[model samples]
Target: MKAAKPLPPYLVRRYQGWKATTYSENSTWYKHLANEGQHPRAMVISCCDSRVHVTSIFGADTGEFFIHRNIANLVPGYEPDGAQHGTSAAVEYAVTALKVAHLIVLGHSSCGGVAGCMAMCSGHAPELLEKSSFVGRWMDILKPGYEKVKDEPDPETRQRMLEKEAVLTSLNNLMDFPFVREAVEAQSLSLHGLWTEIGAGALEYYDPAKGGFYPV
Candidate 1:
């Protein structure tokens, strides 16, 4: 077998050029950010998918948004853990330290993890569900959505539907945290659910008026 070719030197040079441009363009903000620390206005919970970067899509600048990513952007009902909860820890810091005014739970179409959750609903082995590992247990958080939509006519189509429904489900679960609930009640914070389709490059926002998601 032939060894793989190395990346072109031109590509590396272009990245270096862009890095210089970014530093020059964002010098003031970067300087202040380094000194003052991050005080993001919102916190974003999104998937770990490389295609679904929240900052790039939203045109966010440095220190503007506190973000946490995991398999399928799950919030696990605010567990009282002895160790650290990465997602919850980011949320707590965003709320308390940054005084974030919004918490957005972002889900997207064509998510592999969502498909995995759907697969679990299709009668996987007991040992698979009993693994007690991170991904397996995290998928359990979206079980209600999977179960609710499992009996649909087509498994593939239902999986897609469940992906969107799971976003709403997780948003509802965010309120299970007392701090999140209090912030909402006081009108100091708000929660939002968003869905994006990677293939079409279209975005959707949850519309409370219609009680459904609509393209933005």
Candidate 2:
């Protein structure tokens, strides 16, 4: 493979500083993790948004959470067809191999992917309608979620509703995986849905019994 371009000076300096300070301070723990392998208790699937910090929010240390970040934090319905499915592969590893006790789907407010799905479904983003658009194809997972909130009269409310729907949709889709279902039925694994208010640092959790998200 061709040599990759060097990182920007600012980022290189930042990494050097981290290596001199944080890495030195936690060198022992880092080495232990490398040698022992990870045994994270929970697997957190969250959005790729830069603002969402899963470790900071949970006060978790390295090796505590197996995290997977993707646009809109979606989990597609199970399809056994042979294909390259990054999310499914990660889920399989986390559940079947790692045996994580908890699977958390973490969504957040002001999600771009959710907004894009809303726009595409509302006939606003014509470019996303093209078959070759990767984001369009990925956001298709959340299209059903848009349908649930499209009827809401207020645009802001609709957008917020869809954000929460993204969490619920992922939670439901988790069960579509046979291994996930088996784990749940065996009471070995549990699923949760969470949504965060990015600016306010507030979190809400989904309640299956109530069929709504409640502040946490």
Candidate 3:
């Protein structure tokens, strides 16, 4: 097979700069992290959006949190059918292997994936109905969320509501995994849902009692 292409020159230059500055300044600490395996106390399953920087948002360092990124930051109901389930596999490793005490699902406003689901479910995006569309199939997980907010008349409100619903949907799905359920039930693990208004730099966390996301 032919070799893969190299990274763009800008990325190469950035990496070189990082190696010279950040890596050089923290070489010993980096080596220590390599020698001692990660023991993160939390795991964050978040969207693949470039604007959602998990590390920056939490002011985290290396070996801080186990994180997984996927479109819409979704989690599917547990299906141990032996198929390749990337998100589920990450959850399993974090909960059972890494033994993280907290699992967080972070969703953001104006999510393209959520918008796609809204469009598709409303019969506006026929391509997503195609059998070969991976994104469409993956986004089917959010249809139930759409159903809950389908009647909201205001477009912006509906969009915002659906985005938050994505977090709730994922939180509900996480319970389907036996390990996650056992750990949560045993008080060893806790689940959290968070939403952010990226442009405004505002963050809100879900309160099970309040039944809404509140400012943090």
The prediction achieving the highest TM-score against the true structure is 3
| Candidate 1 per-residue lDDT over residues 119-152, each given as its tens digit | 7767664444777756768889888888778889
- Sort every candidate by lDDT, greatest first: 3, 2, 1
Residues 102-171 of candidate 3: C-alpha lDDT, one tens digit per residue: 9999999989999999999999999999999999999999999999999999999999999999999999
RMSD (CA, angstroms), candidate 1? 4.3
Candidate 2, residue 151: CA error in Å?
1.1
TM-score of each: 0.87, 0.98, 0.98
The TM-score between candidate 3 and the true structure equals 0.98
| Model 1 TM-score relative to the real fold | 0.87
Least accurate stretch of 10 residues (summed lDDT) in model 3?
Answer: 1-10
Off by over 4 Å in 2: none
Query: Would you list the clashing residue pairs of candidate 3?
Result: none
